[model samples]
Target: MSQAKVDNYKKSKANRQKIMKREKIMHRLEMVCIALVCVVFVGWIGYSVYAKIDRAQGTAQETVEFDASAVQNYVSGLTQD
Candidate 1:
């Protein structure tokens, strides 16, 4: 082959190698991003469930402290037709 053709072939081969490296780096970056997103999503779900449980316990405690007479009065009001 002519020298010019050989040089062209070498340049093309080098470009292909560079492109492959870039693609590999991009694939790794994508994987890291996906993992980060998954971790954050799971953390949010856990926090939401924890907050709901905490709020429910607090509300239960508050509601459990009503006076007996007040409960009787309220029950009587509800029973009236």
Candidate 2:
């Protein structure tokens, strides 16, 4: 082959190799980003489930209105009994 043609072929080969290398690096970065996003999503879901369970545990706590007289009467009844 001619010198110019050989030189061109070698240059093209180098360019192709560079492109492939860059593509591989980009692909690896994409995979890492995807994995990180999945991990964060799972963590958020777990937190949400835990929060719901915690809130549910408090559902049975009854709140009594403040009744000073009733409280005093109960205290007196307890003392007499």
Candidate 3:
């Protein structure tokens, strides 16, 4: 082969290799981004569930200390509005 043709072939091969490296790097970055998103999604779900459970556990029922009939009479008067 001529010197010019040999040089052209080498240049083409080098360009192909460069493109492959760039693509590989992009693929790795894409995987990392996907992993980060998945982690955030899971953490949000976990926090939501934890907050729901915490709220349910924190609220406790209490016994009423006043007379119900007296309260009912006051409520009836307020309902006149």
Q: Give the TM-score of candidate 2.
A: 0.57
1-81, model 3: which lDDT tens digit per residue?
999999999998979988899999999999999999999999999999999998997786567787799889999999997
- How much lDDT does candidate 2 score? 0.95
- RMSD of each candidate relative to the true structure: 7.3, 6.4, 6.6
TM-score against truth, every candidate: 0.59, 0.57, 0.59
Show model 1 residue runs off by greater than 4 Å. Answer: 1-11, 62-81
Write one digit per residue (lDDT tens) for candidate 1, span 1-81: 999999999998979988899999999999999999999999999999999999999877744455699889889999994
Which lDDT tens digits does candidate 2 get at residues 2-62?
A: 9999999999897997889999999999999999999999999999999999899889778
Q: Which lDDT values do the candidates have, in the order given?
A: 0.93, 0.95, 0.93
Best by lDDT: 2
Worst 10 residues of 1 by lDDT: 58-67
Q: Of the pair 2 and 3, which is ahead by TM-score?
A: 3
* Candidate 1 all-Cα RMSD: 7.3
Q: Candidates ranked by lDDT, best first?
A: 2, 3, 1
Q: Clashing residue pairs, candidate 1? A: none
lDDT of 3 at 23: 96
